[model samples]
Every structure is written in C-alpha cells, then in structure tokens.
Target chain A: MSDLPKILHVEDDPDIREIALMALEVVGGLDVVQCASGAEALERAPGIAPDLLLLDVMMPGMSGDETLTALRKVPQFSETPAIFMTAKAQHSEVDRLKELGALDVITKPFDPMTLADQIISIWQER
Target chain B: MSQGSESYLVSLLGPATAGAVVSLAILLMIGLLARSALGHRRQLRKIREQEDDLALQRKAVDMHAMVKITGVDGRILYANDNLIQTIGYSVEELRGRYASDVFLDEDPRIAAEMWETLRRGDAWTGDNKLRRRHGTAIWVKTTAIPKMGRNGTLDKVITVYTDITDAKLRQQEGPLRAMFDRLQDEVYIFSVDDLRLHYLNKRARASLGWERLNYRSHFLSETTSTFDEARFRERVAPLLAGEVEAVIYESSLSGRPVEINLQLDESVVGEPRFVAVVRDISQRKQVEQARAAFVATVTHELRAPMTSIKGAMKLVASGATGPIPDKPAQMIDLALRNVDRLLLLINDLLDLEKLDNAQTEIRRDPVNLAELIDDAIAHNMGYAQEYGVTFTALPAMPSTLQIVGDRDRLMQVLTNLMSNAAKFSEVGGVVEVGLEDRGDEARITVTDHGIGIPEEAQSRLFERFVQAETAEHKKRKGTGLGLSIVKSIVERHGGRVDFFSIPGEGTTFVIDLPKASDEMSRAA
Candidate 1:
C-alpha cells in the first residue's frame, strides 16, 4: 500500500539489471528492488513483499524455476503476479512459461525504457 | 733178269726226283696265296665288329633313360630320347649344346669342380632341376662319367638323368609345415568320414594342450563339458550334412570359458571336415555385466528428481493453487524457461549417456542437403532478424543437394550452427551461407563477420558447455552446448566439421558430408 506499485526484478546480468531498474523506476514510475541471482531474489522477497516480480530465465547456481519453487513455499508469495524475461520467445516456450503460473513472457534484449510500463499494463489487466 | 730191273728202277728214281722238285715249287706258291686270303678275312671280320658296336651305341643314345654324354669341353656330345623329351629338346638340338643349358641352375663353383674332376678322368653325380626346351623346370638326377684312353687320359663323359618331380613336390611340404606352426588362430582339419583330426595347427594344439598325434586321442565330449559325446554328435551331425552354415558353441574347458566357432571345410570331396576357432570371452562378459549394472543404477537415480521437478512445475503452471498474482507471475515465468532449459539439458545428457553406454542408434535416410540448409536458416531467421543480421546465401548453392542422413537430426545440427552464428553476430552484420556439390559429397559453410572466436577457444568450442572467453562473446549469450551437440550429430551422420576464425576479424564453419538418396528409391 504505498500508492506506488512495488516490483521485484531478478536478473543475473548487470546490464540487464540496470536497464530493468531504470525502466521500472523512471519510465513506468514504480518502486523497484533488484537482485542479481535467484537466491538473492528468494532471500529479499519476504522482506520486500513486492506486488509484481520480473525474473530472468537463465542463471548459474540456482535456476529461476527452482527459485520460484522455493518462493511458492512462502505463504505471502502464493498468488503474486510474475513475468519472465528471456531470449527465447517461441510460442511453445511461452506456453510452457504460462503453465508455470507466469502471466506473460517478456522476451529479452527488452526495450529497457518501456519494460516497467509493459509490466504495469499486464498487472492492471489481471 | 734182276740186272735189267735194277737199271730201270734207277732211271725211274731219277725222273721221280725231278717230278718231286716241280711239285714242291707249286705247293709253296699255293701256301703263300692261302696265307694272304686268311689275313684279308681277318681284317674284314674286325671292320664288321666295329660297325656293330657303332649301331649299339647309337641305339643306347636313343633310349628313354634321361641321358646326356659330354666331352672333355663340358659340351653335350649325346642326349638320349628320354632326356630330350623331359628337357623338351631333340638329340640333334642338344648335341654340342652346353650341358649347363639343360641344368635348371649351374652354380659356377660346382660346374668348375665337375670339369676339373672329369679332366682327371673322374665321374660326378647329382640331382638338379633341369630347364626344358619350353623353359619349364624339371627335376632330374644325372650321372656323368669320363671315358679314359689306355694311357689314362679323359675321353668322354656319360650322364643319365632320372626325373624326380614327385620328390621335389615332397620337398615343398616343409614350408607348409612351418607356416602351420606359425599360425596364431586355432586350425584343425578332421577327416569327414571318421570325424578324426587329420591335421592341427600349432595354435590348435597349444589351446588343447595336445600334440599332433593326440588330436584324435580325445573325442568331442572331452573338450565340450556342456554336452556328452552322443549329444555333441547329434547337434553337429546335421551341420556336417550341410544343414547349417556354422555351429557355435560356448563351453568351458578346464574351468576357463571358451567360445568355439565351428565351420565346415567344403574344399574336399567324399569327406566332410570342420575348422574350429576358439576365443576366450570371459573378460568381455564381465565388462558387459558391469556396464549393464551401471546403466540401471544411473537411470534410477536420475528418474526420481526429474519426475518430482517436472510434476511440480506442471502443477504450478496449470494454476492448481487458484490464480496467480502479478509478482509471483514473473517468478513463475522464469521458472518455466529454466525448466525448459533443464529439459533440453537432460535430453542432451541422456544422449551423451547413451553414447557412453554404446546404445546410441542412428536412423539414417536420404536428405536433401540444400533443403536442410534452408530449413535451418528459416529456423534461425527470426532470431537473426531480431539482431538485425542478414543471412545471405550465395547463388552458387543448389536448391537440393542430396545425401544420406537422419533428416531431423541433421536439421538440428545445422540449426545449432546457425543459432550460434546469429547469436554471436553484431547488429546488421552479414552472415553468408555457402554450399558446394562435390561428386559423392556436399560441403556447407557459414561465415559470420561478427567478433571472431579466439584460436584457443576454437579448440574447445565443440566441447560440452564451453563458451567463447571474449568480452564480445559475453554480450551475446547462449547455453554453450550448441557446438558440441552439432558436432555429435554431424559425426553420427558420418561427416566432419571444421572452422577457421581470426579474433577481431570473422569466423567460418564448414561441414562436409556424404550425399544421401531418397527413402523409397533406397528401399527399392
């Protein structure tokens, strides 16, 4: 409830991270918290309790699917809205993402300027 | 009357004495003539004896005992009918011919020694292979003797040759025995009728730990513990009747496992024989057992985690726990992509495992190489377009270059290479694809003008999960298993891949493959 929407951005790449941050904060006019790895995202989720979460599809150590599995174990994140940023945007791939409880898939090399707006529209529709 | 008779007797006696003188003169002349006639008759008889001796000598020279007579000069003075026939020459042709000409071999020292002995009125005897008039070699035993004068001087040499081709053939058996002794594989020749060993090679003897004569010492039952003599005979009698191509028996001899492959020797008539090759396969059996166990263990371990993870992902994605909100939705999306990546990784790992287990099966068919290239290009064109990279194929490339392969797999290989090219290329950079039709093969090449891979990285580029280690490579990301999988698929299709690249310039990957035929046509 702060009138501003809260968003979580989980990405392994630094460039992708900075771009996603600027897109949410300045362009989409939302409050954003960024994490470098899937483990960090899981750790910060309980404290931050963001309204929407944006995640990169691939990372070392723990994968996004595994991290999401861990997140679903927490009560507060049981029905949170989520989207994935990935380089693969084939229809079969998107269908699989949908099967994993994702609202939509945002293909990577995303126009960082309009990323947060795209997420907001998706969220408001839900 | 007595005085008149006495006077007449004296007159008669004087006349008789004159008459006796005349008779004596005449008798002496006749005796002289008779002596001359007797001497002439004796001379004529000597001439007739000489003529008879010459006729006998000529007849002896014509006889079939392989014979050759030489003079002091070692030149052939006489060659018999048999020697001429065996040496394929006429007596007239051989006479005055050097005796060495008929000898298959003339060792210089032996020839010289022969002449030296014959010069001292001695004889020589030896067996040799003499060259026939037609240049065929014939084995012969020859004897040369020098005929001496009353003064002990060498007059002539008499040589006779006895054909010994059979003995020469027997001499050839020695090398064959030596060859059989040197054989590494077990070889046994048994009389078909008696079912007894006629010949056994050294390897066969050593394996059975028996001598040549002991080959028939033991029956099949002694070596084959699995079956007794009656049963063994029953199983093999049909094979000897030409009912089967071979008889395979795995048995243990002296507690050591042996694999025996018995094949009938059909070379001889009126009798059937067998050739058995025995090999020890105990070690191979042990290794196979160990490998089977390993596969079973690994499959069990991998299946559990995979089932749980996949089932959970499916359930969550299906929204089993009601609807998803905005924040968790993003997390789920990433999870799903990673899951897909994991699935692909698992599939690749399983393929590698199958390769390790020697269970990889390649399904080959006729594929159009040029068409496969098009399909691969089409598959990656969308991704390439996103990067603003133009993939241009040269016009020289044919529309359909045919070769034998697994179609889908080959497409996967080409798509992987193209994917790598598209991912690594800079925005607006040109990627050129080329194809060439060699006689029985086709060559495909992809050239990219983006940041080229380093030589060191190129070496390990086709290794699993190995990515380029350059700054530009980091910008364009991938799973890094593309090249490795591509290489495996290409190699499985019986092809090879090689690439050339200069760091900061460009890279080119070339694939060479055999041409494939159409499925229907191939089956036909």
Candidate 2:
C-alpha cells in the first residue's frame, strides 16, 4: 500500500458516487477514481492500476460480481483486493460476498465520516 | 173340468166324501207352511255366524294396531289396548284427553294443521314425536283417516301410530356420523354442564392420543394443554350464553398449532353442548411468515435510494464539500433526522424477517454484560442528548457477567433498550442500567424515570407495530419494533425479557441470560 492508496470506486447511483468521492478525496485526502458503472470501471481500472476496488453489487450492464470476475482475468489485477458495497447486509449474503473474492462487504447508507476510514482500514489490513 | 156335472152327482152320492176332501186340503197347506218355517230358521243361523266372523276380524286389527279414534272436536273417543300399552298409558287415562295432547311435535302448528286436514275429510300421514307417560318422546309414523257419518258430516278421526324411533335414529346417524368421521378436521362434543368429553370422532381420538375406554369420562382439559378449565370457560362463555353463534381461536396442541372452531349445539335431544372442529394450521402460519419476510426484503431493497440520499446530505452537512449557509444546514439536519427514522424502520423490518425465517446467524462468544452495557450507553450518547436525558451505569455492576452469545446481536438488544429508555425519559431524567449475578444466569435491568407505559398498552407492547398512543409517544417517531427485536434476540440466546411499568411513575425492563459454563467458554 502507498502513503495515499489509489482506489477505484464503481457505483451505479450517481449521488452515492458523489458522496464517496467527497469522503475519500476531500475528507480523507486519498487518491480516488470514480466510475458510473462496472463497464466503465473495467475499461479504466487496469490503466489506472488502483490498489483497491470498491464495487457496488447491483448494477445495470455488468454486476459487481461479473466485473470482479472480469478484472480477475486481467493478469495485473488478478490478486487486487476488492470490497463490495451492497444494500443486503444479511450474514449469509456477506459471507457469500466474501466467498466471491471480496475482502469485505460494506452495507449501504454507510456513515460518511467513517466511510473513508473503514476503506483505509481494509486497505491497510490487506 | 167336471165341476158342475160331477158336483150334482157327488152331492147325491156322498156327504161323508165331501167332508174328507176338505180335511185333506187343510193337511196339505199345513205341510207347505212347516217347510217354509224350517228354511227361515236355517237362513237366520247362517246370518248370525257371519256377524261373529266380522267381529273377530275387527278385534284382531284393534289388538295389533295402535288405534285411536278422536271425535269431530279433536277429543279422544276411543283408544285401543295397543295404543295404551305403547304410549305407557292406560286407556282410561287417554280416553278423554285431546289427541293433540298425546302426540307432540317440535312445532306445535304441525299437530294443529294435521287436525285441520282431517276435518276437511282428508287423511293425514307423517312422522311425529309422541310423548309417553314418562315424558320421553318416541318417534312414530302416524296415519289419521276421517270417518264420515251416514248423514255425510265429519264424524271421527281414526289414527294409527307405528313405532319408528329406532329406525329414525339409524336413518339420522348412519350417513351423518359417517360424514362427520370422514372429515379431516378433528371433531369433539363436550357436555355443557361438566365440559366432559362426550364424543370424539376418529380424527379427534387419533390426534388427541385418546382411546375410547380411557377418554370416555375425561374432561376437555385432559386432551389439550392449551385449554385448562378457566381458559376453556372464558373462551366458551359466549358460545354457552348464546351471545355468539360460533367462536374461533388459535391454540397449540402438543406443540402443533391448530385453529379451533366451536359452535353451540343446543338442538341436541337433551342438553346444550359444544361442538368443536379443530384444524392444524402450522403450514398456513409458515406461509404467512414467509410472505412477511418477502415483503420485508422488498422494503429493505427499496431503502437503498434513501440510504444514498441520507449519505449525501450527511456529507454535505459535515462541511466536507464546502461551508454551508445556516438555513440550508438546518434543513439538511432535519432531513438527516427523518432519514434516520426511515432507516430505523427499514432495519426493524429486516430484523423481523430474519427472526421469522430463522435466518439470523448466532455466533456464540463469551460476552461481558458490564462492558456491553457501557458500550451501549456510549453508543446511544447522541440519542440521549437529543432526548435531553442521561444514562448511568450503576457502579455496583458485576465486573464479569459472562454469557455465551453473539456479541453484536446482544449489543443490538442493549442499544435498543437504552435508546427506548432515553426516548421515553423526561427532560433531564436519568436512565439507570444495573446488573445482577444470579447463580445460573445474569440479569440486566434498565430503569427509566419517565412517563411509563399506559396500563392498557402494556400487554401488547412487544407486538409488531404496536405503539402506545400516549402524548409522549405521539411526538416521537418509532417503528415499534425495538422491543420485539430485543425479545427475539434475547430469546435466541437462551434468555428471557420482561418489564414492569407503572402508569405515571417509571418502568423497568429486565433481561436474564444464562451464564456460560467453563467448558462452554473454553470450547468457544
């Protein structure tokens, strides 16, 4: 991990993306790149060479799970740690997300002040 | 032909011969009259023998048949020995009695209508219940024929009663009882006075684990633990008093859920009784629970947008983007608070779904009660401040009240209790949390000095979406799922939750969790 970890954040909801951008870039002073959808993230992720992938589980063209599988096919991104953000926070769902190569599953409507710190913690642990 | 010449010759010849001829004529007439008299005597003897034979035939019919003759005015004119014996009455006792008085019907107008029909010179035949001397009713088929007099006026009504009680009962019981026994639902009949089990269909006997000989005299309570004497009386009071036609309730029998439908059967021959039909409803309940979970899942999914909206507002309100004006900041704050309320509703709905579906995972770990309470208080500090209340953990709290349970779920329970305590407390009121170490369990009590729950609402406080309609609660927004969730979580950890509340003084909620054994702690 670098002093300022480069992160790729993929979300379908523009408002949630804006909030996460502010929380990571403005509030927590981390280098963050935002994509409107998983397809856009797949196009930009490898070139950006981000240290972490923050993906929304529900999407329009490519779901977070599909995007993760696609990113794993890329040689450089095969072992990159990915975290899932989902509205469903059931214990079983979280465990399932972890089994799908996600380092952790963060429930939505996350506290804005703690969101960046939570991501950093995950990154540092990874 | 020789009358004139012969007469002249005879007149000269013999006076003695003429006298002899007159005597012969007289003797021949006497012989003819004697033969006619003997023939009349023989015909008279034959007529007398025919009259004796007709009387004997009538006597044989009267002996076998239950014959009664009533006059034109409906008064009994004659009653035969068969009728008197079958009616358990003497002929003298029934002779002067009105025919209607002996034959009774559930409907009095039936007898009246029959008599009217007979008066119209028509025969009446139908089944009737005839009362005996002992006041018991015997069913009979009756035929009454009106006998017209020689002057062509209504004369007498001759009625014959045939015993049909046994046959009638068989006709009623054969197909009817068979149909009742073939039903999938369990059927029961309980005596009205003692509430003793009078009859149970085959399904009822098998479902209730009863045998014919052993359950004959058993009371209803013996078969079901759900209905003791008092509860049975309470539930059946309306049915017995005829206040309601039927009553329905749900109860568990042998740990299986059943719906019981009880109806008053006052039309039974003797005493009024209760007829209950019980059907197992466990599958129905499971389906209902599943549907509720589905609705909750959809609702939770719907909250995703609200979550994003609240998150955006929160970020903007924190001055992360830029400094905001005071009015917009206040607006954002208000929106944020409402968002929190919506989130609470969504969370409560999800928790209920999880609880009902048994999808909540319990990962047992050693949890310390005192530390959990302290963390809960700290977590709810902001809420306490908003409610203008303070939370205090008693200094005498046990240091190590350990239990085996999921820490996060237990923390959720404690947080709910503290949040409720803060919400219900008066301004500047102090909420106290205390712990007691019993031998086998640890008890935690949360006491709040505030307007307590109303007496009427206390019983249903833990039911889903049931909020007390008090003035204090009216101003506060609650999903009413906090306490129910607390109860579910505590119970899943092998604990019990209860509360004591005074209407105007204060309330105390107690939760008891079983202590973890050394071996269990080591195993965990």
Candidate 3:
C-alpha cells in the first residue's frame, strides 16, 4: 500500500523479538511493527492493517494457528499475504499451514540480515 | 596198750588154745568185713547228696531263663513258661507255628527276613513286634543262639527274650512324630531308590487334593493330574540324584498358572525327600506385562513430537530455500533451542524408563577411569569457558586406573555432572575434579563454587522434571531432568552418588564405585 511494504511480526521470546526487529528493520530495511505474543498480534493487526503478517508458530498463551484464526475473522485480512515463522517446518505441517490461508512458512533461526528481502520476494510471488 | 593186750591174749590162748584161736580168727575176719562195708555205704550216701544238689540247680535254670526252641524250618518246636506267658500262647498253641505268623501286616517282610537269618545258622538278636494269641501285639527283644552238633551243623535255635512292648509303644507316639505331622507346610518323605512316597503331611494332601495316607506311594504325576508326567519326572530326577538342591517351575492349576518352588531336605541324607511350595503369581505377571506395554506406548508417543521438531529445524538450518535473514534466523534459533530442550526432556524420560524396565543393557568392558574423566571434562570445558567458569582436574591421578564398566555410559554420567556444575556456577568461579583410591573402590568427586542448590531443592534435584528454587534460576533454561538422568545412569552401573551443598556458597557431588581388580579388569 505504501512505498515500504507493511509487515507484521509476532513473537513471544524477548531475545528473539529484539534480534528479529533489528534484522528486519536495520539490516533488511523493511517497514515492520512487532507484537510480543500471538494475543497482541490479534489485538493490533486489525488496527495497523499491514500488507503482510509474519508470525512465530510457538507461543505459550495463543499459538500461531489460533492467532491466524482470529486474524481471518477481520474482513480486511481475508486476502492479505501471510507467512508463518515456526520451529516446526515438517512437510505435513507446512502443507497444513498453507491450507489455513498462509501463503508460505519461514522456519525459525532465520538469517536476520535477509528477513525483509525474503518477505518481499514472497509477497511478489503471491 | 598194744604190749599189755598181746601178753593177756598169749595167757588166754594157752588155756584153751584150739577153741580160742578159732573164735579169734572168725571175729577178726567179721570185723574186717564190717569196716569195709561201712566205707562203701558212706561213699554211696555222699554220691546221693551230690545228685540232689545237681537236680535242684537244673530246676532253677529251667524256670528262671526264657527259652524257645525252633526247628530248622523256623517252626516253634518247644517254648518255656516265660515265652508262652509273654506271647499269650499255651505251649500246645505255640508249637508248630511259623515264626512269621505273629509279625504285623505292615512289617511282614521283616518276619520273613528274620526267619531266613535263623535258617542260615546265624542267630538274630533284635527287638520285633509280634502278634499275641489274643490278637494284641507285643514288642520283645530276643536273642536267638543256634544249637550246634559236634559236626558244627545247626540243630535248633535257643532264643532268650525280654518283653519291651510298653517301652516301644511309648516311643511310637513320641514328640518327634508329633512334631513331624504338626508342621504347617506341605512335607513329604520320598525314597531315592523307588521314588516311593514314604510320608505325606495334611497340607501336602490338601494341596494335592488327596484323601489317602498312602498318597506318598503315588507318583507326583498321579497326585497332580495336570502335571506333565515326563517333564515332572525329568525335573525331579535331578533332585533325587542329589545333583540339584531345589527346583522352581510354573504350572497351571484350575486354568491359572501357579509357581511351584521345590527344595530338597538336606538333613535326611542317603534318603531323598523334597518340599514344594505353590504360590499363585498370575496377578503379578499381569501387572508386569501391563507396565511394559505402557512404557512402549509412552516412548513411541513422546518420540513423535521430538522427531518432528528436530527434523524441521535441521532442514531450516540447511537453507533449502533462499538464505534466512538475521532477524528471522534468530527467531528460528530460539525455536530450535526450545525444541532441543524439549528433546532433552523426552530423552531423559525415556532413559529413566529404559533403566526402570531393565531394558538399558550395558556392554561392560574394562574402561580406563582416567580416560573417561578426561573425555567428560574436555566435552564440558568449552561450555564451562563460555560461562566464564574455570575447570580444573587434580594432578597425579592414576592414568591407567581401569574399571569394569560401560565406557560410553560412564562418560555420559561424568559429563552430565560437570555440565551441571558449570551451568549453576557464577561467572569466573572454579570447579574442581578429583579421585580417591579406596581398596576396592574409586571415589570421584566434582566440586563447584556456584550458587549452590538450596536444601529444599537438593532433595528433589534427582527427581525427574524437578527444578530448583525459582529465584535467580528462572533465567536458566533446561528441562530439569539432568540430575535425574545422571542418578539413573550411575545406579545402572552398580554405583551410587551423594552430594553436599550450601545455598549461595558451593556444592560437591561424589560418585562411589567398587574398584575392579587388575585380574578382573583384564578378563573383562
């Protein structure tokens, strides 16, 4: 929508949160807003209206699947390009996430420097 | 008197010489004959007195001594008053009776054997029970001596006997027999030669469901109908031959398999006897089987999730797609670490279950204790440096102190302890490792100057999934099963662990293992 592609990042771990923010914002140079938990992303994603949402698969309170289900309830997010960031990227799990309306999956321990570039390329392909 | 008498005889003879001389000669002859007759009569009277004394002595012996005369065929030929009275038989009734007729039915062979002994010219002397004429049995100790002719041929047997019926009957019901029949356990006496059952207790009869006392004569298969005859005979053969002391077997009774534990009685030497105890263990076997199934289910279920998480992480790290960016890669790293922690937790649980199930078999061999310690220390040193802690091993330790052990498992145990030390220690703290040589054991101790576990936590530290106090420890990440795994692995190796800790000060963990001698080490 804007000159910078809007990206939504959800995470529960503080260290991973800080590292993810730096890699996507400073290194990859992408417009990004961070949510510390799946619950926070559900609450704020509707308001921020991002073009893409990048979600961590595991969180204690609300898992990525649950957050995604909540996001799909919003009318504007129905066709928004979304990707899952998870530790579990098995073939079956990846296929299951795609069926749940996710465009793609990015495994955790991701390279921080190229995270935003990956998001753009996925968005272009979509 | 002789000179005066001679002078007077001479004067009288001159007066009437012829008539006086004839009278004197006749008188002298009569006197001589009278004296000789008196001496013969005195000898005859003395011989008569000696005859009376000999008859009295013969009468006394005949009446006082017990006498029995048996023919060469062991038939009673003659008996004295004492023998007839003791056996409750008249002489007319005792005569021509076979010696075996009076013996008890249970011991008929004894009577036949005793008769054979007498017929062989050897006298039999022993106590035996004989049935009286009134059908009441009396025990008598008899000594029979054979009467022999000048040619050394046996003519008859002269037996002298004493009645011991009352004494022998008293001993028959003595405390020994009472004690034997009163035992609570099933007991039996079996003969080695014929395997004849000689004795059986009330419990043994009840266990076998037998009502007859002569069940002892019945074979084991006959008593236990369900028992496999050949198998039972084979199993008991060893016990009978004195090769095996006891035998244990599981057999079915009323469709339920029962455990039978048979033990030989060692005190009754030369005669074989066995005592068997039957116990029902069907419930225990069922419980064990169920436990094994549960362990298998848990292992399969737990391993599934762990495999998924670990495999996916490995794929992501290898970059099948475009390379991952720094921030996303860091998030992935966080997930990977948590997955690793979960995997460790599962591994620890599975390890404990394996140990509990006795499925964790160790291939034991002679392992150099020094090398084991060195490898463990080397593996942990990098982590120790990362935590800014110093690790030190005491010098002059035996480099070749070998022990019979599973090398890999022992290394794992030592590494776990050292890693725990480094993880719990403050930065720049020191950890010490040392070994002491005991006569039959080696004691390895690991000391760390760390924020030692609190007393309350120390007790639970070796329990599965148990963490220490929440304060100052919440930052550390772990599955909280390291110490438990260490304890289990150590115990499996026939070793034990002990530790002492002071909160906020330091902690020390000691491993005590029996030292393997050089000979044993070489053999292993």
Candidate 4:
C-alpha cells in the first residue's frame, strides 16, 4: 500500500463521479481514475493497475460486487482491495456485501468532505 | 264393628256357644288388621328413601351437564336447568319444540343423521353445533340414548351434553367460526387414531372440491396429491409421539405448492386429533417476489438522487469549493436540514415496513449495556447540540451488565430515545440517560426536562403519526415515528418500554430488557 494510493472509482451518475474527483484529487490530494460503469472499469482495469477499487453498488451494467467478482479473474486486479458505497440500509445487505471480501461498506448520503478521509483510513487499515 | 251383624250371629246360635264363636271371630279380624298397618308403614319408608336418592342424582347431573328428554314423536318433553341456562331458553319455550329445531342449527343433514341413529336404536355420541336463544352458537359433546318400551317400541330419548366450546377452538372453528370459515388457509381436523377428518373449515371444503356437507369419511390421504396412508402417518410421527408440538411440511398438493402445519390437539382425552392448516404458497411466492423487487427498486431509486443532492448541498455548505455569502449559506443550511429530515422519514418508513412485514430478523447476541449507552450518547450528541440540549449518562452499576439483543437494533432504539429526548427538551436542559443492573433484567431510563406529554396523548404516543401538539414539540418538527420504532425494536428483543409524564413538568421513559442468562452469554 502507498502513503496515498491510486484509485479506480466507478459510479453510474456523472455528478457523483465529479464530486468524488474533486473530493479525492483536489481536497485529499490523491490520483483517482474515474469510470462511469462496471464495463468501463473492466476495460480500463489492465491500464490503470490501481492500488484500490472504489465501487458504487446498484449501477447500470453490473453491480459493484458483481464487477469485483469479474475483475478477480484478471491477475493484475485479483488481489486489489475494494470498498463499496451503497444506498441500501439493511444490515443484512451490508453483511452480505462484507462477506464478499470488501474492506467496508459506506452508506449513501455520505458526508462529501469526509469521503476522501474515509477511503484513506480504510485503505490504511487494509 | 257394626252391632247388627253381632245380633244376627247371636240369634242364629245358642247364647253361650254364640258368644264363644263371636269372641274367636273378633280375634281373627283384629289380627288381620294389625298386619295390614305394618305393611303400609314399611312402604312409606321405602318411598321417602327412593325420592331422596333421585333428587340428589338430579342435582349432581344438573350442576355439570345439560340434559334433554324428547318424546317418541320428537317433541321435547323436558329440558333441565343446565340445558335451559346453556341454551338461553325458558322451560316453556323449549317444551314441545322438536329437539332438532332447537339444537341442530336448522341443518337437515345433521338432523336426519341424528334421527336415523336414534331410530336404529344406536346411541349417537358426537360433537353437535347448536345455536342458543340469542343466535350465538356453541359446541356440545353430546351423547343420546334411547329408552326402549315393551315389545320394542320407542319410549323416549335422553340426551346429555357438556360444553366443549373452548376445546373446539383449537380447530379454529368455534366462536370465531364465521371468521374462520372466511379464512384463506385450509383447516382440517382429523382424529389421531384413524386419520379420518371430522371437521373442515369452509376454505378447506371449497379448495378440496368437496361440496358434500360431510367430511367425516374423508381421510388425510385424500387431500394430498400423493395419497399414501402409511407415509402420511409416518410424516406426523413426531407430533403423534409428543416429541414435537407440530409438523411443518412443504409439499405440492394436487400440483399446488402448499405449506401444511399440523399440530395434535389432545384436549379431548382418549380422542386426540390433528389440526392441520394448509396454505397455498404458489400464489404467495409470486406475490413475495414482486414485493421484494418493488422494495429494492424503491430503496435504490429513491436514495440514489437524494444521495447526490445531499452530497452537493453538503459540499457547498461546507465552503469546500469556495467561500459562500451568509444569506445563501443560511438557505443552504435550511435545505440541508430538510434533506436530512426527509432521509430520516424514509429510513423510518422502511424500518416500519420491515417490522410490520416480519422481514426484520432480530439477531440475539450478548451486548454490554454500558457500552451501548455510551455509543448512543456519542451518536446523538450532534443532534442534541442542534437543540441546545446536553445528553448526560448517569453511570450504570456493574457497567459490565449484559443483555441478549441485536447490537445494531439496540443502538437504533437508544439513538431514537436519546434523539427524542434531545428534541423535546427545553433549550439548555439536560437529558439524563441511565442503566441499572437488576438481577435478571436491565432497566434503562431516559429522562428529559421538557414540555411533558398530556395525559390523553400518552396513551397513543407510540402509535404511528402521533405527536404532541405542544408549541415546543411542534417547533421541533419530528417525523413522530421515533418512539414507535423505539418501542417496536425494544419489543422485538422481548423487552418493554413505558413512560411517566407529568404535564408542564417532564417525562421519563423506562425500558426493561431481560439480562442474558449465564448459559446464553457463555454459549454466545
């Protein structure tokens, strides 16, 4: 793990992606490569070789967990650490996501200012 | 003793000889008269003793059972006090009325069967559903015996019955029988000895395509797609042996998926029966799948845009992008508050729906009471500050006190309570939270110095959409679902929540949760 890890962020909504770009790159001072969907992330995974995966669940092409399952087939991203952001509030759902080998689950309507720090803390813990 | 008969005797014979013969005749007559008096005295004594015995037997029978005697022509000759009281009819009203008319609910089928049994001279002993004077119906375990006259003529019929209404309720067709008849699930009761169904609710009959009024001849095997008497008996072996209370089976019945839960009813000694409730789950499965899809869509679709909207407003409000003017900042703060409020309402509504639908599974684990309290206080501190109120924890004894509950749900309960206290408290008032360790239970209290709830509002305070109408409470503008959620969460964990409120003074909410048993704690 690096002091500030390079990240691959996938979200369907462009506004959410823009907010994350500002929060991570400008505010938290980290290099973040953004993709609009799981398919785009899969296409770019070989080139990015990111240290961490930031995925948004409930996306268009494939869910965040489903995408993680797919990317694990590639040796480059097989051992990559991932964290999921979800709007689903059920504890059981959260537990299910955790069982899929994610670092942690962050609930939606999150504090934008603290998003970068939350990722960094989880990354360090991993 | 007539003198004329004595004088005739004297004239017929000589005086001395007549006198001697008359004396002998008088002695014979007096001796016969004395013997007749003795016989009368003995008969009187026997009659009094017999009357006493019959009265005692009548009193004993009338105390416990209802008796009715009908003439050979079917007219009621007598109805005892117990029968009159139980049927709610006067003696005059019942006399001369046909027993079937008063007791058989006007069902010709049952009446015909009963009369046939009596005419055949076979005693009819079974459960009879009879209507009372007020049209309220009850079940009586009846036994009818016919008295035979000389030359095989029918003299009369004496019927005795005991009210088995409570016992019959296990079949789900008693006092609420009309409602039971309207149920969606099929209910069947069969004797354990012979697996022959004696009763079927209306739904059961309709679904089984059996429009015939009698279900007594139908066996449990007939209702299933795979009819095997031995296999059916084997399946309910546990319930029959009393090893388990019920047998829950999921199988296809006539190509329809059904859940059959059968329990043994041993209320009638020597006549154990099985009460089976069958529900068609094919329709339920489709409905459940659709409901699950809708809930997921609503949860995802509603939260997605709201997440973006809140994030943007929060970023701007924080001045993370750039410096903002004071008025726009205030406006943004207001928008942010309402956004949070809307989110809270959505979360509360989802939780309520989950609880109502029995979708929320409460996980039981050992939770430290003091630690949970500390966490709740920390979580609600920001909200308390918004109300200019402070939350203080009154230290709990045996801070290591433990309870059996779901940690997340317990946290939710405490957070709701603490936040509610903060919201309703007077500005700068201190809301006290405490936990006490009783022997087998833990007592939790959250007290607030606020505008106390009125007496009338307290009764329905935990109901959905009910909030105190006080100006202070109104200004706080809560979703009014917090306490209800709190109560629901606590109750789901097998705990109780109550409050004592004095208007214009303050309110204190106390929760009592059972402590985790030693075995439970160790096992967990």
Leading candidate by DockQ: 4
Order of quality (DockQ): 4, 2, 3, 1
- lDDT tens digits by residue: candidate 1, B428-518: 8888888998876689999988788977787788888888777778777676777777787777776899999987778899998876645
In candidate 4, the residue pairs with backbone N, CA or C atoms under 3 Å apart (3 or more residues apart, or in different chains) clash, namely: none
- TM-score, chain B, each candidate: 0.49, 0.44, 0.49, 0.54
Per-residue lDDT of B1-524 in model 4, one digit per residue for the tens? Answer: 56887788779886788889888988999999999999999999999999999999989988989999999888999999988987788899889998667755446787678778887788888887777775556788888898878868778999898888757765654555577688899888887777888778899999888877577777877876687777788888878688788898777888888889999876543356788899999977677667666777877787787878888888888887899999999999999989998998988887776665444568878999898888888888897888899988996456889987899888888888887888777889999999998787899999998888878789999999899787766887689888889988888887899999998788999999989988788867
What TM-score does candidate 2 reach?
0.53
Question: How high is each candidate's TM-score?
Answer: 0.42, 0.53, 0.42, 0.64
With a 3 Å backbone cut-off (N, CA, C), the pairs that clash in candidate 2 are none
- Candidates 2 and 3 compared: the better one by TM-score is 2
Q: Each candidate's DockQ score against the native complex? A: 0.01, 0.33, 0.02, 0.50
Off by over 4 Å in 4: B1-184, B188-274, B281-288, B388-390, B393-403, B436-442, B514-524
TM-score of 1: 0.42
Score residue B422 of candidate 2 by CA lDDT: 85
| Per-residue lDDT over B264-303 for candidate 3, one digit per residue giving the tens place of the 0 to 100 score | 7544212335666666667766876777567655654554
lDDT (CA) for every model shown? 0.70, 0.83, 0.72, 0.84
Listed per model in order, the count of residue pairs whose N, CA or C atoms clash below 3 Å is: 24, 0, 20, 0
